[model samples]
Target chain A: MENNLKKVDIIFEDSDKCAPLKVLEKTLKRTADDIILDLIDSGLKGRGGAGFPTGLKWKFTRNETSDVKYVICNADEGEPGTFKDREILDRVPEKIFTGMAICGYVVGAKEGYIYLRGEYNFLLKGLLKKLSDFNAALKKLNVDFQIYFKSGSGAYVCGEESALFESMEGKRGEPRNKPPYPTVAGYNSKPTVINNVETLVYTTMICHMGPEKFKALGTSDSRGSKVFSVSGDTPIPGIYELELGMPLHDFVNEFGDGDTKAVQVGGASGHCVPRKKFNDTIIGFEGIPTGGSMMIFNSSRSMYNVLHDYLEFFAEESCGQCTPCRVGCQQLLKGIEAVKRGERPPAYLDDLKKLTGTMKIAAKCGLGQSVGNPFNSIIDNFREEIIY
Target chain B: MSTTEALVKELVEKNGRTRNSLMPVLQGIVQQEHFLSEEALICVAKELDLSAADVYGTASFYTFLDTVPRGKNIIRVCKTITCHMKGKDEVIKAISNALKIKVGETTHDNKFTLLSANCLGWCHKGPVMLINDEVFPELTPQKALEIVEEYAKK
Candidate 1:
């Protein structure tokens, strides 16, 4: 299984050979349907953890009739352990802009926006300069597409597409109801193609190397390699571009500090895979799909503290627009604390688990709904550690 | 015109006086002034044609869009799990001890305000802090103090 762990280089590949502008020009020669079909053939899902089919998302927005449409790059990389998007924005922003331009060409959008999180505001000045150059290049090519930057004030909920739209509209970053999804009514209440920054980069790569090349990498469900932000209890902690569908055991063996106890796949909202399940666990859509957050925990760390930290984070970051999320997060935090303080019996853990169940069903958005993933996995695997 | 009023008017002119311009307008004020004063909020509401409450509502929702008065420089130490794992507490303590201010406190001179923030997305290089827009990662307590001392002189 360790031998199967191969590092891939499609993401940070030198742009001299596969230049983004050249890829855009080559892609524009093809019809929009053809480009979308290539994306569909590539089987590239949204790299932002939701796993939505990227081609289908673009096709939906493209199909919608609208006077005004937008292509948005969701650069709000606020997932607790995820930092690949930041590296992407810092190193190769041209590729991201070009990807958005291609999306604009395909989706009939004249304007695009990158809703970057406020913490990464340091990158804004450099990004703006690069964007202006990209815009100039677009004008020279007679492409009527332009990209702009929108800074999100420190709100994690704004990472949600609809909440991002709300933030862009100068409102509170709250997730709107679905059905009128981003494709149908998004930023400024028009048809929009909103993609993760990494997802857009993959679209550009798919155009450069063709779908067959990308489709050859990972399993059918999760196609192409992904940029993983590896941190915590690891000897070499940093970003890695690895082929998907490898067993979790291989990842632990490669990145672990040798005394690894558990790995928190994805961010705080993602699942906690105990060491025993490493052989069975797959780091792809077929098993525990992550948005590229692989936080390895060694035996030295306490699962109790990790879970407590996560609950506290969720409690603070919840938008408070939905009661289920707002109150549920608070209660979970309290519930765990009470158990640890001996205010509640060990049996009380089961009741709190039920509360997370309610949160799973009742919470309005992914932030609240996914809290159960970490809560259940941690409590189920390390119940004694959480108790006393 | 008051500085706040002038700033608000200037931001509206730059970003456009629309409902969508509310965020950038507020962010502009915070960038310059460090926090949204009541006067700044009112000016923004008046310039953007909204109620003061409406403006404040949006501003207060974001952690970075500080409503209370902040110092000339804001020091946000990343307190998320990874940073916590990599000795953010020691870093925070060092900053607090050096500045004679705890987390969420402003210096008497209004030169610096120390606050612990959530993830700044530098997990690999943990124990990170942002002094305003500039991010400093992979800090020991000594390095954290040195960085703060350098900012204190400014």
Candidate 2:
């Protein structure tokens, strides 16, 4: 079995010379167009599960003609199994701030905000101190951009770009409709560039090491390495900067506890790949793209419990704006419980699967839409486990 | 002005009386008072020039914003999948037994509140608990009890 799993050392490397501020200084010298072009060339996608091309997002936001554009670093790391963003913020916070500043520069915005989740309130004091220093540095550079911290009040939906904007606006963190996307009308109904914390750090890294170096790693779709938050049923459970497009089999061999039966790629909203399908699966944009969450489950763990937990999470976390997600999540949870309780027949699981299918399209935001990914994947892979 | 009114006014002054300042204003009250009282909410609405219903609407949407009374120290145990798998039930049980109260209940002395939270983002170091702004991760039942006892002493 040939292993294509390659571990990269770019993300956590602590060299004082190639610091994030140095990257920002060099990036500031270049035109906005040049920076956007380099980002597009690198083929970097959003690391926050959505996989939208990072360069195109910046380009769109840059093209938008507005007087008061804004830059936001989405530090609301609420995804169940994904803890890499917090680790990034804890370790290389300047890199994130630099990325936001660079984005502000690219998109013609003077103000930037980091929407840190309330759960990570513990990180706030340290982040605020670092942010003040970074803001001072930006002022010394005559950049005119100052980053601010906005804390999310324990809402998972706020991780969604528009919901994050709403949360910042002191409203319910319900996602707004598209067409007026973040690129055009984000915070305060102005053109805004909102990116995940990791995405921002990668932008800083790309500026520092040239786009070609990042382009040299991973597949065509998923270029460069990503910081993965690997946990559950693994001996070495922690953050790993691994090259994307690696086969799940390779990941399992490297990180799994030998008895790994299934792996939850991404978070609870992501897919579940059984051990049998591990060889066929790829962990990248071209395959099962993740937000750097890979939770491995050993054979001893019950698939029913896993699916139940995910359903419960979605049901609780759903913003209740739409019926498909709000009603659908609760029904699915109830339907599974009834089946397990011997009230509903085993075939009733198919009806619940169909409900998730409806939720895929009917639900308003990603929270509702992607619920079926884990629901269907777990049910498909371990049907018997979900039933008696 | 009453203390709550003074607090709300100070928060409004610090954060501004804009609609955008509502969250921070509410958060400030929570930080000082532990939860948003009706008087605090009304005061914030008056200061921010919003209806009480509008203020409550936003506050109720967030899990962290407690509308009801909470203890001096909030003990939020992570009840997400990873935490559950890593013996969060036992940790919760330990805390419940220690505090002599179930989940979502505060101590009789109003010193600590025991509640279950969705996820605290420390999946690798599972069975985590957040005591107010601080976090305790990779917790055993005994470790959890010890931590709670220390808080109780304080």
Candidate 3:
């Protein structure tokens, strides 16, 4: 299996061949329904941590009977351990814009926006230049759609789709009540479709290469290659597009420091798999899913410090509107501190575990629900590191 | 009226007079003034047909939009997991000791304000710091202090 490690490059293959304008020109010839059908058959999922089916999201938004629908590409890549979107934006921004334009064409929307994070303000100038070039090409091809860019003001919760819409609307970046989802009432109460930067790039690929060819890459559950931002305690710490469903042990053997003890699959909100379970863990939807953040830790690192860093991040970034998230994060962080300082009994951690489970069920959105993931996983795997 | 106020008014006019333009308008004002002043927030609120509370709520929600005054240059040290494992703590300590200020404080000379940020998205080159818009990655304690001293001279 190690000798036959299949690595595929669908999104960041090359600039000219995957050029946005060229891909758009080819994709625009297909009817809207055909494009949507191709996406549906591609078996692609949102690469922004959430494993939601990408085709279903586009289909829902396209079927909505709204005259003023909107398409947004979520470039607010604020997840602490994730940075593949940043690399993508820097290398092949045209592919992202092209993907958004294709979404606009299929979903019957004329306007699109890329809600970029504020830390990435430096990228604005170059991305705008690319957008203008894409727009000029669109005009030559007589495409009616236009794409705009919005800069987010450094809020992590705004990475949430509804909160992103709110931030784009010049309001506080907070999550909205979900029943009338983004597909029904979003971005000024119009039916909207939002895709992650990576997801949209794959959309372009599904259009360029037929869905059957695209689906032939990864396992049955997870299709296509995933661009992982591998950092922390690795010999080669950079971007890697690996076939999904690869075992964690195989991944560590290839990229690890040879002293790898554990891996944090995904960002702060993702799960932690210890070395004992590395062979059992698969890097895909069927096993331990991720948003392409693989932070490997060796024996020298302390799991206590790791958990503290993640809890602190969640405490700072939680959008405080909901009680379970706002207060629950504070309690969890404080609880971990007490445990590390020997102030709280080990039984106190059991209570904290119960609290995190409550936060998972009661919190308003994904942010609150996922804050407990790392908290529970780290505690479960490294209780010794915490107590001693 | 002050030139700054007039310039802000012009920006509000240029971006358009709508509630949706609130973020861009605030971002523009912060870029020029380094922080959002009370008068500017009120002015933005009035121009965008939002209350001052609304403007303040939105402005304070984002970490980049400072509600209070900041130093001439903002130095953000990345403290995410990768950077932490790469000895970001030592780099942060070097800057603090060199500047004679703590993590969340500004230099008395008002030249640099030190801050700890979560993942500047340069984890590949671990232990990174962003001085204003420029990223300095693969940093050590000595290199971090030298970078601070270089900025201090400026």
By lDDT, who's the top model here? 1
Better of 2 and 3 by DockQ: 2
Candidate 3: DockQ? 0.78
Worst 10 residues of 3 chain A by lDDT: A1-10
- DockQ, every prediction: 0.95, 0.89, 0.78
Q: How many collisions per candidate?
A: 0, 0, 0
Is 1 or 3 the stronger prediction by DockQ? 1
**Whose DockQ is greatest here?**
1
Tens-digit per-residue lDDT, A1-388, candidate 2: 6778898988777799678888898999999999999999999999998989999999999998888999999999988999998999999899889999999999999999999999999999999999999999999999989999988889999999999999999999999889789998999999999899999988988998889999999998789999999888999999999998999999999999999999999999999999999999999988999999899999999999999999999999999999999999999999999999999999999998899899988888999999899989998989999887
Candidate 1 residue pairs in clash (backbone atoms < 3 Å): none
Cα deviation at A176, candidate 2, in Å, is 0.8
Q: Which residue pairs does candidate 3 place in steric collision?
A: none
What overall lDDT goes with each candidate model? 0.94, 0.93, 0.88
lDDT of 1 by residue, B1-154 (tens): 9888888899999999899999999999999999999999988888888999999999999999999999999999999999999999999998898889999999999999999998899999999999999999999999998988898788
User: Would you estimate the TM-scores of all the predictions?
Assistant: 0.99, 0.99, 0.97
Clashes of 2: 0
